[model samples]
Target: MRRLIASTFASLDGILQAPGGPQEDPTGGFALGGWMFPYADDSMDLSAAGFDGKDRELLLGRRTYQIFEAHWPYQAHDDPIAQSLNAAKKHVASRTLSTLHWNNSTLLQGDVVAAVTALKSTPGPDLQMIGSGNLIQTLQAAALIDEYNVWTFPVVLGRGKRLFDEGATPSALRLVQSRVSTSGVVMSTYVPGGDVQPGSFVTTEPSERELDRRKKMANGTW
Candidate 1:
């Protein structure tokens, strides 16, 4: 079975929307589009992290596919990134997109989960998802992703589409590898480990120190 990997560029607050450009995704009046531009460095290799469409097919949502289709194809003449994206097989999930004009692009039929599950069982290289926030949520809920390449930038956008938004399944992840970029971006790779382990530090009986602290707080003495 082929692995399904999801790659994302996120802010400190987990906002994954519009990291590329200002006009990318402005929905909900998100003014901090292109928040990642300042942190970009030549030393950071996106392709080395498997985000540049090498040895893998592309799985994308409607919005992300459209964004790539509009921009990548135009650069295919001289850019390697454009060439790879143009030639890669694209599996896009959308309810409204009837026709896909990009080369080697296919619109997924039937239920999204079922389609992706079937694709995973097929004999092929791993399928990688890039910047599809809504689609990521669905796959995350179903526990379909095999790996995650999450690059967390330092900026914080208080409001925007996030990676693990509401309705995402609560699952524990083990850090497999990590590196800090020169620009302070934390590039971490993780795999699903198991269920989340719940714990607490509270004790049934408070110690004398804890009791004194609580008493001081109650009396406003700090």
Candidate 2:
């Protein structure tokens, strides 16, 4: 079976919204856009190249789809990353958009979770999700993601939409790979490690005598 990989670019404080421009996503009064621009370097390029090399189909949310539709198609034919993105089969998870402008794009209809699950079971290349925060949250909550490629930048935005929000379905993951870029970006790959194992604290409960002794010590009655 093909894996479903979810990738995200996040700030140190975990904000994943609009790393491109101020107009990209100003929701919740987020003013800091293009926050990840300064750290662009060879390592970033290499990371993009690595993603392009995955030989996977593309899965995206509406916002991410719109962003790519506006830019990647205009890139030169010789650009490897752009070519890969433009040529790959794209499935967009959107409830409102009735039509897609990008080539090889398909609108995911019906229940989002059901649609994605059906895709996961189909015979084809792995599905890769890039820069789709809202979609990522849904896939995560459904426990459908098989792997996560997190490229965590060094700076913190302090506020914005995060990659992983609260109330997500509890699950565990194992770090399978890690690397550090020259600009302090940490790239980590994680795979699903199944359900979280519940464990109790190792320390024993304080005895009554021990508690009384501590109380006496505090009261100077030791």
Candidate 3:
């Protein structure tokens, strides 16, 4: 089965909206767009994070798809990132958009979750999701995504769209690999571990062993 991997750029506080530029997304009056630009460095590997679309198909939400369709197609032909993104197959998940203009792009029909599940079952390269926050949340809630590539820049947007919101379903993620860029960007990959494991350390009563130990201490060898 093909795996679906979600790759995103987030702030220190889990904000993932508009990391590329100030014009990317400002729906909620988010003035701090392009907050990740200050932390860019050569040590960070974009290909490893699935940004170059080297060996995977692109899965995008409507807003992100529009942004990419407008920008990547206009880049110079020799641009490696642009070339890779333009050449890769794009599967856009949109409820309002009925058609796509970009080359090698297809509109996902009907229920997003079911369509994605069907695609995953077939033989193809892994699905790589880039900046599709809405779609990511949907697939994530459905437990359809296989992996998460979270590149966290050392900055926080006090108010903005977040990677994990308050409504996120409780679950566990296991960090498979991680690295830090010279600019202090924490690049990490995670996989779903399981349901949230609940625990507590507060003790309300002492056990028999603890009681015996307490008695021994009080008696002082009697």
Clashes of each: 0, 0, 0
- For model 3, how does the per-residue alpha-carbon lDDT over 4-46 read when each residue is reduced to its tens digit? 9999999889999999899999898988888988899889899
Q: What local distance difference test score does each model get?
A: 0.92, 0.87, 0.92
Compute the lDDT of residue 20 as modeled in candidate 2: 76
**What is the full ranking by lDDT, best candidate first?**
1, 3, 2
In candidate 2 the C-alpha lDDT for residue 207 amounts to 90
Model 2 per-residue lDDT at 33: 89
Candidate 3, which segments miss by more than 4 Å at Cα? 206-222
Which pairs in model 3 have colliding backbones?
Answer: none
Q: Where is model 1 poorest over a 10-residue stretch in terms of lDDT?
A: 75-84
Q: Higher lDDT: candidate 1 or 2?
A: 1
Q: For residues 1-222, could you state the per-residue lDDT of candidate 1 as single tens digits?
A: 999999999999999999999999898998889999999998688996777888789999999999998989887387878877888999999999999999999999999999999999998889999999999999999999999999999987899999997798999999999999999999999999999999988858998998999999999999
